[model samples]
Target: MQPPSKTTPFSLPVDSDHKATKFRPFTISPPHMRAFHLAWISLFSCFFSTFAIPPLLPAIRRDLHLTAADVGRAGVASFAGSIFSRLAMGPICDLLGPCAATAAFSLLTAPAVLSASFMSNSTSFIVIRFLIGFSLANFVACQFWMSSMFSNNVVAVANGVAAGWASVGSGFTQLVMPLIYSFLINTVNLSSSTAWRVAFFVPAFFQTVTALMVLAFGQDLPDGKYKRSSNITGQISKENAFTILLNGLKNYRGWILGLTYGFCFGVELTTDNILAQYFYERFNLDIKTAGAIAASFGLANIVSRPAGGLVSDEMGRRFGMRGRLWSLWVVQTAAGLLCFLLGRSNSLWGSVLVVCCFSFFVQAASGLTFGVVPFVSKRSLGVISGMTGSGGTIGAVITQLLLFSGSSGNYMSTQTSISLMGILMVFCTLPLTLLYFPHSGGMFCRPNYPPTHQQHYDHLLQCQ
Candidate 1:
């Protein structure tokens, strides 16, 4: 069977016959819905395979006999591996094309994730986990795919839904992995040790399956369904990859936005891993309870992050470029304050409530950051995506170092450190609203881009 026609697969109406079509839930039809649907799965799988470790931390620590700091280091190592690798994802995705890149990450990472089933020692387990981080580069590809399919006016909403939905896996895994592990033990009669190892089979299988499905069924462009021309163009030159990388990193806005993302998404990555343990220690709860509470942090991303993007989209209409910037600052600043308040809370439920609030703003900030990312430069979306995506991992690496370095990392010490990190997040982001980008479409004092769409492939295919 052939792929569907890409000329606005969704039977939705277009405002201009010569411009890109806009899709909203109310007006969405087939097959654009098909592309949008699968794109989120690509992103969901990237994180599902990469972060599958944290939700299983209790089993991981018991099987490996690791200390708390050792667990923290293991999580840090995963982020450390991703910091630079994610930067490479953009150019690589552009070079390989998003469809190929998405499928490739799934196929490539499956073995590494599945290998956890046979690990004999902490060293091997940690090494395998670190390698899994490489799959996170798929995130750049997923975002770039959305940018290609949607109009600029609704891109933020599209990105937020895609990212927000993908992020749910973190929390869902937290709530579910324990159940999966238990099912393996009780139903299959596997030993507790073996159950943990066998549990990884789930992520490995899902990862591979999702990849094949996307490659087989997904479309790369809107004007033509399942076209391979862009994929062929991606392979034409290795030199093109380096050029894209350099151009992406050179954008000062990418750097600032990346840093801001470091505070939100990066912190979320670290928090996802640590939250389970933190709750276990701070509230003296069992691993199951702690993991469930931690899952709540990620669960909020489904709605909160989209709210951020929707807010940015609305702000852009009212305030232009500054609106996106303003939304980011406000959400992030609120998140910073929530972090401090969370640290000071005296009761367990009190802290958990604050954490839910914190989760909302932090995840929303992530959506807002990406809302602005595409506007940085159309020619370099892949590069910018990688650069900004890496920022979150970079932030996780730094946060882990600073938070765990000087302290024994007890509950109080951890809270105090996070509060300080919150202060730092605000200070770091303040200069961004004042900065500007001119090349993409702005002035020195203000950065703004008029939202416009193309009827045919342009920014994505113009990679020469």
Candidate 2:
């Protein structure tokens, strides 16, 4: 049995490389779909743990006597913790495989999620938030797992569906946290402080259970466990992890995609932190009401991101890489405009409508970004995924520290900061125009050598 060549239009059932040509998301059978289910669900629990605090911030602020400055710094610290972890997770994935990487990281961070319940002061609160944030690196593992399980043709959709479903955890927390808090206070008769504190136990438990599930059920590659190659001396040095790391770093496309991801996914992270507070203060909504509205932004990922992947694939079938780039540019541009409008809207209803629309485009842009990622360099996929994934946290850190961080004393008003972020997002989309490949040309040009039906996947072989 041989791997599919440059001219093979479709793969055989369970091809020699063990990658699946067709994607059947509903089925949870072994190899492809089973990995897909575990990958997204594990990351979803991480997302749940990472963001469990934001919706409860109002009650937390009063109980802990936290000022605006303290809250701002905590937000920055949460995103900051993930930045380095995301960069490191890439090489770790290459060395250890996504299954081991995800399971280990999840277990390591689960205690941090539980620790959030014990923090009494702002300092301890900030530290616990930082530790819990390390789980976000699971995102890199999720993307890496999907790339390993699916073939080139369906990889975009696989990546999109996996990531999109996992991101729903952000919204799920927004909606569920408030309800749990209400249940504790109303039904259990616990005080507000105790209710919020005890609520932490739920996500912590959820995260721990999911991590164990991955360890017991998940496989690294489609066929089985990841095996390392041996050198002439029979020492296990077959794949030089450093060379894989360096090769991915050398590719210019990864950097461009990383920068672009900052605005879309980074903005999403920043919003997840601030949105409930925004509606609470600006609109005078109750805690539960504000959380439900905030959840809408994240829940939109269910359809929006997959739509972006679907549209990108359809465009690629017709216009190759150029179509993918153009669709990304257009959709992201709309997201920026809506973001600006969201800040400027005066009424609560109007703002909510704008936010829902903004969520769609911004999340779709994330899906579109990853749709191009797997094609960058198959050999260095983990490294490239790490670079792009880290870029999102970096973007959130900058957005938080400079614009949303009230501790800075010179930070802009929240509304003004959001509008300015929109302007920055528009500028970020410009880099997508600069990306090009050998057989598939860029935004403004046509390919010098047009590809045949099977040659469309040739970019999987080389970065250029």
Candidate 3:
């Protein structure tokens, strides 16, 4: 299929006399729905491994005789691996397609995680964790696969649903880890080291299972379905991937979206990964309590992501505005402030409410951030997504470091550092919202050129 010509906004060349022609709507089947379910499960498994480790840090530290600073360094190493892998996987996905890439990367993840299970020291653990970070980049490939399979109108919702489910992995680990720990201690009469090994092994086993599932059942869509043409006149090179990457970077829309993602990620990571440890130390809470509180963030994420997408889509139709993106930024900034205030509050209930509120807006912001990606460059969705995702990972890396170094291996200092980061996030919201909404037709509000009647029909059928 030829690429849509760069014509006037929302105009596509067609045989005017053929306007009356009836076109059969494309329909998805039971198999396709099954594929989507498995893909989401695979993605959830991947995320469980990626996020489950952070909450276990205090236990790992106590068991392994490690320092708070060392734990933070481990986070830095993990996110650093994510940064590089995101960059590498983007082009790989664009070239090889999402299914093969997802399976390949997921299979690689199993061993990286399994290696962590046997680490004897902090250095070995960090190295294995970094590799695990690199392997978990398969989540990006999953995103590409889901986006390609779904129609544009509902792509945000699909992404949201996957993201929401994936967040559950963290919550699941939080809820299940204690049980697993208890089982190892009481039933198996295992040592602490052996119990930790079991925790790591569970994710590795699931990752292996998910990889086999993908290899067996995953199907690649025909190239014509989603691959954008590379032949933009004097603009993008067909063979040079770097040229395409550079061109995407040059686009103003891409940078704006990337910045929005970066800011949101920085704040979210600070709270999700670092704050639990900070709270435990500062308030003298037990490891289990801190983990439970942190798990609430995931609970909020599971609910808010789909709500954000549904609200965004509805608002887009009613107001002809991309209120989802802009509104989320403003709301998330307020949530960050509430989190900062919670850090200062001595009341436990106040802190919990603040954290829950923060989680709600942060997850909503995440959905809004990804919701705009397809609109940026329909042809180069994977590459564009990779760049933005890389930016977010970079933000995570920086925030992890800031929280780490500022902690100075002290509990009070860590809490202070986190609050300061939250303040910075508030400032970040201004530029992001301004850049994201230019007073022109905003990202999600802009009419899709070359109207996808088949997509609309599919959405309509789903609605019915």
Candidate 4:
């Protein structure tokens, strides 16, 4: 067997160092926040690559001479890869570390991503897309990293920012990809196929570089260090990977959270892929114009998703575990209504406005769902996070399969179906209020002491 790696997990921090024993919800200097920063960058690369194809779909269709059914199948194919990849990654992050999990995915998928630039037919392109989908697992690692590095009280907020900011790539790509395509077309005098092909190269370069950065500088804990990957410790590594995965599968609450995610974050993913196409078809807008509208929906995630986390955290301060549940319930219910409204609106800008509102609540609901994730089982956080993250993929698949499928689903019928999906979101929120998650202050108030695994959080939060 290979010798034990030198990168052993750092022993727990000393308690006498009061400087390392407090909490700060809004600071840039803490180790947890540092981890958060790195995590977002890695997660951003994954999202950027995952979404790179959608905004360019219109151009791709024309170039390849593909049917609408082909595009819809590609969307399904992307998320289908995400579902299984995330399920498996939870165990990998447990065995490896977040930094390894994130970087490995980034570097491993790079060749497939770059090769997509050369695919001339729908079959090869769809296969390449499935390969790209593996990057979505970075999201699970991103959250697992944050939970390891932060306190329970503030974890939701940290998760919110990391997830929210990382998601900007999806929206930003929608906006940015078009400009790249346009620049190549208008300035460099490239054909539609060639211009779009070059755009994939941009994100491919960033992903490879960022993955290296994470491997070089990323940390698995908040103690300001990273040792050899083989030196890892913790619940993720405390038990066998298979046993840990089994535990996650048995945790029904996680399954419920995953279901809720199917609607909220699922809508985000589905919309990210289809919204541009919808605008292009309904308003007869050019790809650039429709893409801009869709990008607006994605950009809303910067503030909106974090807002949900902040709200959940505030609720936790006041109501403990119940607050997190309440916040998710209220926001998702609102999101469902907004989806209904989005489907009904006929005006060009009016529909865009509805999408923005829908984006906010759905994104917020996603943040709120995660607020409760870490609390599920500290030892199983990796598996739990992966399972929960997969929930979004499930939702996206349903939406595309039902509302946006090329042959069976049409734009004319979208409004009614969208409104119905909203109601489903509202109903999903109802059960959480009764489902118990151990919390502070007697379930309705802040606890005098923190929950399990929170002592380390306090240590990181404490300022010298």
Task: Point to the candidate with the largest TM-score.
Answer: 2
Scanning candidate 1 in windows of ten residues, the lowest lDDT window is 439-448
Residue clash pairs of candidate 2: none
Cα lDDT tens digits, model 2, 65-129, are 88889999999999999998998888889888999999999999999999988889899888988
RMSD for each of the candidates: 4.7, 3.8, 7.6, 6.4
Candidate 2, after superposition: displacement of residue 385 in Å? 0.5
Best by lDDT: 2
Q: How high a TM-score does candidate 4 get?
A: 0.87
> Model 4 lDDT vs. the true structure?
0.78
Model 1 over residues 1-464: C-alpha lDDT tens digits?
Answer: 12224763345444331113555643335445566778777778767777677767777778788776677667777888787777877876666667887888779888998998887777877688788888777777778887777666778888888888888888888887888888888899999898888889988898898999888888676554332233334544445676767877777878888888898888888788778877887789886788889889988988988888888788877776767777788889998888878778879989999989999999999999888987877667888888889998898888876774433544337778778777877777786665464423331254233335331233432442
RMSD of 3: 7.6
* TM agreement with the true structure for every prediction: 0.88, 0.93, 0.82, 0.87
lDDT (10s digit) by residue, model 4, range 77-145: 888888988888888887777888888988998887898899899998788888898888889989888
- Please rank every candidate by TM-score, starting with the best: 2, 1, 4, 3
Error of 2 at 119 (Å): 1.0
Candidate ranking under lDDT, highest first, comes to: 2, 4, 1, 3
lDDT, candidates in the order shown = 0.76, 0.87, 0.65, 0.78
